[model samples]
Target: MQTHPPRSIQLVAIPLVLSTLAGCASPLQPQSSSELQRSMVLAIEREVDQAKAAPERRTLSLQTDLTKLEIRPDHLKIIEDEYSVDGYLAQLGALDTLDSPGLAELLGEDLLGQPTTMVPISLENAIHASTGNNLDVEIARYAPAISEAGVVQAQAAFDWTIFGEAQYQDSNTPQPGQALGGGSAAIVRNASQTTSGSVGVRKDLTSGGSVSITHDLNNNNVESSFFGATPVPNPARTTGVTAQVTQPLLRGFGSDTVLSEVRLARNAERGSVSTLRSQLIATTSDTERAYWNLVLRYKELVIRHKLLQRGIEVRDDIKARRVQDARQAQVADAVARVERRRGDLLTARTNLRIASDQLKSLLNDPNLPVGSEAVILPAHDGIEEELGFSLVEAISDAVTNRPELETALLTIDDATIRETVAKNLRKPRLDLIAQARLVGLADTFGNAYDDTDANRFVDDWILGVSFEQPIGNRAGEAGVRSARLDRMRSVVQYRRAVQGIVLDVKDALNRVFTNHTLIEQSTLSRVAQGEALRSLIVEKELTNAGYSIERLNLELNQQEALAAAELAEASALVAYNTSLVDLYEAMGTTLQRNRIDLVVPDANQLAAGESPMERAGDGQQAGEQDAEGDE
Candidate 1:
């Protein structure tokens, strides 16, 4: 009896064979955390590349679950899931792809009549989905509310005022005269009562930097002294009116002042809104990319499996040749057959595992069910590929639409507002005031009305202007200078953004064109490889030839060509999708109907601004660049 190596031993022999051919197969070997992270990143980039080819019309959900999180300036960690991204990439990291369905099942499903729908899930979607449940869009959107509230507060200083006052008091004490005369009761009751009310309207002078007001009022009072022999009538009543005004004459109105700050704040709020919109654009682009990654993975697995079956046929043919020729020993030929079969088997298994893992990660399903692998639906929707004139049109769209560039422009606007405020603070403090009042006093309420005359009313009025200047004004000047520099920086960044966008669009276009050529070349190579295999097979059958050698060689070559063809197709798909993604990103509207949320000072603050209803046909503004330019 002869014993062959156990399956486990054969599996062990895999690495030995791999090492002998082209170094060790260390796919399962432990990798450093950094290495794993790098691999993941590259994987993510590949997915993004694939997604750009296949755009999905996914609606950006208003509510994102980001329960797992840390909001450091440069990084985010999913405490629950053990996932994290460095702060440097967190905003952009949202564009990575998530896991998808298994390739085996998805392909089978496709064969079984259920075509798969392939969409690119952007990195933004993966980050958002995994951390979305905990993300409070409302919190981020809350900023505008606070800004508006600030406006209200700014105006409150000069709106309107209404005041009222009332007092009643009673006291019991011994009277000096009564105590000295040994009065029957040493306690005396004293009481007093008073009431007053007023209503006024106020206004602020924007040009003059002054305060003006007018008021109307009424007063009633009574004073009684019961400690004396008898209660004495002591009643006093008065009614008065007043008008007051104040103006600034120097530095206060010209430079450092509350009014200036209020104006700057309003501008800041507007810029914030623009910034938010930009963030949403970036997130949407990311989500779209991720969705397509799953599709590509599914496609690769199917192709690999097909190649594996071809390898099986080749192995059988090699074995038959060995049996047919007894004189020509076939040790080397048999070994090669075994190597090819093993290599194909290993490759097929590895691809299946990789595809499964990727799908699980994207779905945010770590504990994926035993059979719940990702399945890629056929993506044959046939998106109209942008060609020739469309390419030019797309370029124009991107320049006018990319959100990051637009956001950068808004940052410049924000800086300009700050500069304006800073410059305003450099003015001297100045103010002016004028007040007039009418007063009347009488022993009785009826007499008080009659005594109410300008002169008799104790007419009092005054007008004055005030001014102040800081000795050095160093702080004010420094602030203005700093703001000016910041404004300059913003402008530079804006220009850079525009340049970067133009370059990115052009580069993506070139890639698309290059892939077009590769697709054609790969197709030709596949044809040539097929002809070579057929020729070698015929040659071996026609004559008593050792042509099995040539047949085997052709088979290997054909295998390589087919693999290249598949890869080229994948690349072409990615390049095509990338062009579309770049076009939409430039246009600033990837998810036609639902727009994603942008990262802003307070994204939660703007929650109310984003409506849940689809705005596809709405007359809302599309891209910031065009809107701002028009404005």
Candidate 2:
């Protein structure tokens, strides 16, 4: 008995020391409600999966106010009164309904008395499915296709064309337009018949030149009885082959002007690809954010459930004490905590439901039925992994890979091409024209063919130049000036895009670091609470005395601490994952991350210019800021 007193004091003091040490410790196990949620989610998921696996007489059953289905993100107290009795009753009823053979399960109870099956959906599966079915991504996917069609349309102007024409004319003139022939001065009737046919191919050159080759055949017969003309008994047939070309000598010459449309179209095509890339990255990032939000809410629900369970235990313990020892106020306090947590539990469940709906919307899973009764469950929980980030590297990567940055660069390329074309157009229009022809004249078709020989062919060739200038040319000057301004505008926009990307990367990195640190601090506080609760539990057990009020109060404190810890833990993980999403998107590497092979028309093949990925606007500024609005 003498040695037992020292041992008792040591045992009593041990928990206090451990509680102090726990303030620096880390957490391992998540709250009990997570397991509860996981089970509930699994059950619902399995049932939904079974429904998809085999067709059934599925029908809509549960109905609620879907318009106000979601609550605001604010955490303001929405319970009617300070101690809402109705709210408490409602939560209790809900809990009872969700229990073994509960209301939620019984409503859709199977005919054969089989359990509801649940399907487990992992995060990766959700992302993949979301990328495929997300409406935003679907809308963006068509942009690239449209851009490709535009490029094709722009290039079609330079294709070759075949043209042919045929005509026959018969005419007779009487005394009004008479001619004399055969030494007769008397007025005679004049008549003529002619047939002509031509076939040709014309092509537009990329150097702003045009070439055409044509072959013409004609047959004609004339009769006259006047001195002005002589009557011919036979018809004359003629055939000729001609080739013509027109080359620009001043304005609209060279690739800059000739291929301006094609170049601009190619830039536009690249911009479209980048735009789609941005959209897809945004979709996946949002999917991740919503997914993690679901994780946090689920964990919060678990914490609330545990708190209520603790409150129930404490309330019962206080009741047992009230009968033996006088502790009425403590009993009331325990009951109050229970009711408070009951309200919280209901809120948590509501939030959980809201999150589940959001995840379903993001994934767009076909198996998940539409309605309040349908549920989509998460297969994975929050996880914390050690990660590192470099600000310089992030900025560098973003400058080179950010979709917006690339788009801005493409815009500059487009502006530059247009500017060059506008400048070139300011010159006077001068074209060099040349043509070569082989002529044949004969009375018969065979004679005409024989005349096609090089020696007999008539070398009818022509060469000339044409020039035109707009008076004053104010329109041309203004167009050139506007194009220069456009190029400058694109430069400013690109610089601004780089700054925005850098800032975005910086913010994401900061969040990641901050959340990781919070994880450590939250885990420590949770450990401390667990130790304090343990100390109290041991103190109450050591004595045959009735329950200690302090021990009961400590349980409440421990419950609060546990809830905070779970929240911090889940929040930290969510923040980390969200940061990575931002980082990858800012770097324009999400396509690579998701293993998507985006197809974009090569700008380099279309023109000589640096790509948007290479620089901002007019030049490359690795680390610079500018003021410009997005187009």
Tens-digit per-residue lDDT, 1-631, candidate 1: 0111111100012223223323323221122223322432343233234334543322211122322222332222221111111111122221122113442232343323564323222233333442221123323345565766676677676555554444444433344425546646445544445455555565666554544444333443333245444323355666666777766665445433445556556655664565545545454455445444544554455445555555666666665666664224444554565576566545654454455445434333222322443342222211224344233333344544555754564565566666666776687776777788877666665566566664487578787766776899998899999987886676567556655665676676566566555545543454344444445555667866634655565665666565556556555555555555654555555534233444344334335445321121243222212223323
RMSD of 2: 20.9
Worst 10 contiguous positions by lDDT, candidate 1: 1-10
- Cα error, residue 399 of model 1, in Å, equals 4.0
Off by over 4 Å in 1: 1-191, 196-199, 203-205, 208-233, 252-273, 276-280, 319-376, 381-386, 389-398, 443-455, 537-550, 583-631
How high is the CA lDDT of each candidate model?
0.47, 0.61
- Across 1-631, the per-residue lDDT of candidate 2 in tens digits comes to 0010100000112223223323422111123224322432343233234223442222212122322323232211332211122222244443212222332342232224455332335566667666766767656666666777789988998888999999999978766443346543455577888899999999999999999999889888886655336434258888888999999998988976898888778777778888877877888888877877876775576567667777888778877776666378777888888998989887877787678778777765555533434434454555454443445444445544678866765776677777788888999999999999987778876687678765488667889999999999999999999988997787677656656775686677677677666666654554444445555565778875426666667767666665665566567656766766666776566666666565443434223354322222343111111101100
Output the number of the TM-score-best candidate.
Answer: 2
- On the 0 to 100 scale, the lDDT of residue 91 in model 2 is 48
